[model samples]
Target: MAMAVLERFAVLSSPDLDEFRHSVSQFLTPHRLTPLAGNTAGVHTDLSKTSVGPVSLVYCRNSGVELGVHLTENVDYYDINLALHGRNRVTFGRDEVVVDASRAAVISPRMRVDMRLSDDYRQLHVRIERQALTDHLEAMLGRSAPAVIRFEPDMDLTGPAARGWLRTVRILLQDLDQPAGLAEHLLAAAPWANLLMTGLLLAQPNNYSPQLERIDAGLRQPTPVRRAMDVIECDPSADLSVDRLARAVRMTPRSLQRHFRSALGVSPHEYVQQVRLARVHEELRLAEPGTVTVTEVALRWGFTHVPRFAGLYRKRYGTPPSQTLRDAL
Candidate 1:
């Protein structure tokens, strides 16, 4: 099966800074951030609250050749930056590095550094209370963080993980002005926060026992149904019988059926068919010339026997797959 690189999340962007500051102050002690020359940077208070901490997202955009940032004072909290677009030259402690799209970097508390961008760039900046992250770290590692971590931006660590983290951040960032309870929404972001931290911890290999525990605990979180859905999504053409899907998630067929029915109000077979048809419909919208045949696409998503597939397709979409592909052309 081809690995379709799915975009899991996006980052927050804004034109409002006052609201951003108020939201950030909920979690971190507010400090005046000196703006960088030749770039636009703003922090917006998202009215949402997460389980991990209060929500505030920052955006920095540089439209010219380069932008540089110098931290003069030692901060008492943890901060993370993800280059959403273009490139950056970062100097942290004794390390000097260049980071571009698909890469992320972190600066430890009290670590003064200089950051330079080589092209027009935008980045998502997240600041967390030092003690909150420290508690998580200590719980995972069984000790305190070494005074500092000198990070050299590496694509391997940042590419996939950073993309995933930013996608989730962007979602919460949107609820900032909806006249809703920001605190509850922000608190619910704990899972995302945990995932972000887990990715960072995995980035640097250290003997932190508590940190390991946290990651392990996250893995143990009940997600069998989600996992089963993912399997269905990955290869819709497979034999997705009730017993088979149940086995994939390590649950009994009866148990799985009961749980899915309770949660989604649909039978497993019906759900799988719906997913499979949806995939066919999507492909039909942009299917390439001749490469994706009506018969092939249908069979691929577990619709064996062209007549049955065609009948089902017509019933749901009011058009056949052949019509879809032809229109796409």
Candidate 2:
């Protein structure tokens, strides 16, 4: 998957030194980019950026050339740089870390940075907007904070928290490839953005970790119904019968059903079916017109009966699945 993330949003691919510097300055951040290996004769700078909600996923590579990039001022956004191939040394202020696939350097605002890239270095930069992050932090705190949230520079990506956060990133990247997909829907996009933001805030230790921990210690564990719904949402195609879901969440079947009814006003079966219908609706909208059929789409999401699915799809989406596919194409 080298240089695979956000490859569709290519901005530049050139060997010219000035052009390479200009491309990085335009597509990513303003930096003094110079070749460290004497000359950039055979080096190709590849860059791409795709914006999704409050963040942008940028893929960049300077192939066959050691490079040095300097950012002399404080940046406005948080840069989570994950190396895809080879290695790089990112220096944030006085702290420096060697970043690779398993280690990410999270550069927060109010810091100067210097980056040394190996000859084969390639990376994906998750650029989170400053204002959006501040707003999210305020929402999480349930109050205004006068001080900015500053994250520790080096993030260990081997932990479960980082892995889960990366899942949301992969989901967003997948959606960005679809013309009529979840990222384009406000309702869906907001949750994904919130999931990413909330995950990062909770997973990574920051200036507000102590406060967040205090708040969390005072609250009860997340409701089982929410976990069940997350299971379905994360992988709707999984076997999600009430028995399985209840077992997954360590609850009895009857108790799980009761909780689902009380919280969602629907039984587990109904909720799963609703999720499947929604998934089918999304699939139809993102599928190519000539490549798929309504029945195929229905069955993929576990809707076996054609007539019932058509009726449900129409009632839920106000259109037949075929019509949605047609519109998408």
Candidate 3:
């Protein structure tokens, strides 16, 4: 529901270089832009942007000229740039990288960046809030990060995983084009935002890579099981699949399952079901009898099959779900 707070889409275009630069800065970050020495009377710039929760998808093209942009003070977000046409020479911190279709770049927050774009350059950029990403990292690490998380300037986008991430971005952009897009709904947008963030975290090499690798190896000081349990208890309605839970606590699925069984005498899946069942019971007891049904409550808590859900409800609550609803009424 928090995803519903922002406007969904916008488009901006201009033939005036200064106007275009100003518009782009308003949409993204503040930067000084200088047109390269092509004494042209007319240059065209087009920008399209879609905001889905904390993440923004932007596509921009500047034709018939080269340009240089300087961001002396780092912006408070991460920029993942994918050059779709032509190329860009990006200098961030001490490193410089050429970004094109095959090579992507992740620009960290608060880092000075100098970039030069070719005449026909077009790019698909994803901007994610630093706080949002840092929160996600903390959730994955099961603790606060010791320092600022920085990424390598260049990333190989031709790999299978990276390609998959690109496909997701393309789909998101396409969805945003519709008048009644799926992203307009909070439920759809929230998951899409999470997917993009999680995908970026996994795809890009960052400060947390070693810790993640350690998690995969089952060598961690903080207990992942406890963290996983805490997450489940805090938000049972979250999309807490085995993979997501495992990633949160920095463990392989097998490792997480083993730890859950060893500590709680139940698998993670079973624990989640139990928690959902309890939540369903609480909601049913509090519901106005005819206003809500058992099936609705069951589905809300992730139980899909009505007959099977009734059976489980009976087993857990010593009564049919309908009876619980009826009694509450």
Candidate 4:
């Protein structure tokens, strides 16, 4: 499971140099901050953070300083720094990158980073939990990833895809600031966070890119039924259309339908519905009392019509979804 992000904005700031470092460490990561020689001006730090599900968005600005950040032993998540002003030299393991307006730095969960920031440095930091990303990679490949996914340190933000990612970040930031933002609702937050994760995986070059390309090219092989099952199990919430499943396994829809009927005794569409209904039932069973509704769980698993979904749920489980929820509570 992915780590949950904060549900509301948190602001941390301090004028004392040592206090500033301590505050930042508590909010983000543990690190030592050292003011450069002859740069003894009052230390000022400001950070505003909001979490959209499992992703954390942080806006940070600090006075002139150098930081010695250590994650060698406790590398738990991926951190991406997009420079908004000034400059930074970020070193990860043996590699280093100069981060500026045009370049972003991606620090993997396995690496230790040391950063040197210029006087007017400001940045947007995106933190993604490792498990969440790993799950996504597995979904994309229709199988478990072989190892931890690694990303190129330097990302060119001038590219078209990168620009689109930035646009999404901006939109999320704007919504976070609004009193009635989309992120305030769980239903909306889930998709928005998922979009950010998917966007980064697609726009950036990563260790899994080659394998994903192979799948897209329809080169390597998996049995049609096995591949289809993998896709459904990996992401039961996806829109699992017959055509989509057919293309994923490199088979015509007609052939897929015939095979599914012959082997599973059900059409592809029916199988998808069964998977979704099971997912909804599991969620309802585990959901906190009074915090979630049957409709929300149904919609989350792609069931749009309440009457139709309830009828199917009853037929499958011998009880209405509302009754299932009540029993769980």
The model with the greatest TM-score is: 2
lDDT tens per residue, model 4, 195-237:
8888888888998777566455432334887788778778878
TM-scores of all models? Answer: 0.43, 0.65, 0.64, 0.64
Question: CA lDDT of 176 in candidate 3?
Answer: 74
Over 1-329, each residue of candidate 3 has an lDDT whose tens digit, in order, gives 01111224446667888887787887678888888976756678887776889998777788878989897567789899888788999987678889987898888887878999998788877999888887777566544443577888788888887788888887777677666888879888778988998888777888887765544443332477768978887887788899999999899999888887655556889778877877787678768847888888888888878888888778877888788778788
> Which is superior by lDDT, 1 or 3?
3
Give the CA lDDT, 0 to 100, for residue 183 in model 1: 26
Q: Model 2: per-residue lDDT, tens digit, 1-329?
A: 43566666888888776787777776566788878877656777788887768877888888878988898557878888888898989987678999987888888887779999998788888888888887788666544443677999888988898888877787778777767877777677668777888888887789988866644542333567667767877877778888999998889999988877665556889878877876787677679758988888888888778898899777766777788888889
- Model 2: which ten-residue window has the lowest total lDDT? 213-222
TM-score of 3: 0.64
The true-structure Cα RMSD of candidate 2 reads 15.2
Colliding residue pairs in candidate 3: 74-110
Clashing pairs for predicted structure model 2, backbone only: none
